[model samples]
Target: MSPTTKNAGGDRAGGLRGELTPRRITALAAAVIALVFVFENTKEVEIRLLIPEVTMPLWLALLAVGVVGVLCGVLLVRRRG
Candidate 1:
């Protein structure tokens, strides 16, 4: 019956619908679909660098790339500091 309680209820309802415009939803959906191809089950594949061939499981390759990216970001930040 309190005025503050009514205001809080209205705010919660608004939040459930989200605050994003239609454009944000389309962009997010496209990004997720694109990543689906990157993580989908794939057999070991060979990547050729220079004159050498490196064979690795698709998932392992993805994990290594992600870790390398994080390390690079950290190094860059430390160097900047």
Candidate 2:
């Protein structure tokens, strides 16, 4: 193919490579940071609810809260979109 001719294969590859855009990079960084935070905080703590107190590893509690936050964000975005 001549340099001036558009390459369909090149275009497809570029599209795939562009998948890791800034937003994705930021999300990935956030996930890594959250993981590190959870790992660093492994001590047990008390979580008191309305009726009872539960004790678990701090990492587990943080992970659970992060999952819930992600789910809420997804639901809100879907509803708005």
Query: Over the stretch 1-81, how does candidate 1's per-residue lDDT look in tens digits?
Result: 865666635665655376778888886886577467557846798988689999987867776776687689778878541
Backbone clash total for model 2 is 0
Q: What are the runs in model 1 whose C-alpha is more than 4 Å off?
A: 1-39, 79-81
Leading candidate by TM-score: 2
Location of the lowest summed lDDT over 10 successive residues in candidate 1: 7-16
Off by over 4 Å in 2: 1-18, 79-81
Which pairs clash in model 1?
A: none
Q: Which candidate is the best by lDDT?
A: 2
**lDDT of each residue in 1-81, candidate 2, tens digit only:** 778786756566555465678888998999999999988999999998798999999999999999999999988888641
- Candidate 1: clashing residue pairs, number: 0
